[model samples]
Target: SVVTEMTGLGAHTLRGYERAGLLQPARTAGGMRLYSPRDVAIVRRAAALAAEGINVTGIRRILQLEAEVALIRAEFDGVPQPVVAASAERGASGTG
Candidate 1:
C-alpha cells in the first residue's frame, strides 16, 4: 500500500496500528483502506516512536495527549479574550 511504502512500515505493522487504535484510515466502499496525507503523517510518527522503543500503548497515549493539546490550542486561538480569561480562572479554581 502507498502508506506502507511512504512510511517505510510494513503492511502488517500498519494493520497492527489500526487494531491498536492508532490509525483510522478511511475505507472505500469495497473496504480498502485509504490513507490521507494526515494518516500518512501519523504513520510516520508512529513508526518513529516505535523505533524509539515506545510500545503501542505508550504511542497511543502520546498521540492522544498531542491531539488534546492541539485541540486546546486551536480553541484558545479562536476564543474571545474574555471567555479565555473566564475559562482560565475556572481551570485555576479547579471548576473546569
Candidate 2:
C-alpha cells in the first residue's frame, strides 16, 4: 500500500498502528483499509518519533498536542498573530 511505501512499515505494523489509535484509515465494503493523507502523515510521524527514541505513549502525547496546536493555529490564522511565541518559549523552558 501507499502508506507502507511512505512509512516503511509492513501490513502487520499498519494494523498495529490502527489498533493503537494512531491511524484511522477508511474501510472498503470488503473491509479493505484505505489510508487517507492524514493517516499517512501520522504513520510517518509515528515512525520518525519511534526512530528518535520516543516510546508509543510519548509519541501519542506529542501527536495529540501537535494536532491541537495545528487547530489552534488555523483558528487564529485569520486574526493578528498573538504572543504565542512567549508561551512556546515557556513550554520549551519547562515552565509552562
Candidate 3:
C-alpha cells in the first residue's frame, strides 16, 4: 500500500523533480502519480534535503557521492553490490 503520511508536494516541486531527472513515479490509468514505497522514501528524503536549502544540482551530486560511498563500503566489507551498472547509469545521466 502507498504510504499516506507523506507531505503533499505542490505541482511546481513535482515539475522541478521531473526536470531534475529524478525517478519518475509511475502513473495510474487515470493519470495520477503513484509513488511506490521506495519512491515515497525518495520523496521524503528529497523534501528534507530541499528544506535544508539543498539545490537540485547539489542534491543530485550528494546522492551520487552517497551511492558511490555505499558501493565502496560494501566492497570494503566484502559485500557484492551491483556497482558497475549503477555507476555507469549515474555517469551517463548527467545529474551527478
Best by lDDT: 1
User: 16-68, model 1: which lDDT tens digit per residue?
Assistant: 99999997989999999998898888888888999999999999999999999
Q: Candidate 2: what lDDT?
A: 0.86
Best by TM-score: 1
* Tens-place lDDT digits, model 3, residues 17-91: 767966488889998878777667666677788899999988777767877998988886673357666766888
Native RMSD of candidate 1 (Å)? 3.2
- Which lDDT tens digits does candidate 2 get at residues 5-93? 88889998889778888878999999999988888889889989988999888888999999999998898775644566776788999
What CA RMSD would you report for each candidate?
Answer: 3.2, 5.3, 10.3
Regions of candidate 1 where Cα sits further than 4 Å from its true position: 80-96
Can you list the residue pairs that collide in candidate 3? Answer: none
Q: Give me the displacement of residue 21 in model 2, in angstroms.
A: 0.5
Cα misplacement distance, residue 75 of candidate 3 (Å): 2.4
Tell me which of candidates 2 and 3 scores higher on lDDT. 2
Candidate 3 global CA lDDT score: 0.72
Clashes of each: 0, 0, 0
Model 3: how far is 60 from its true place, Å?
A: 1.2
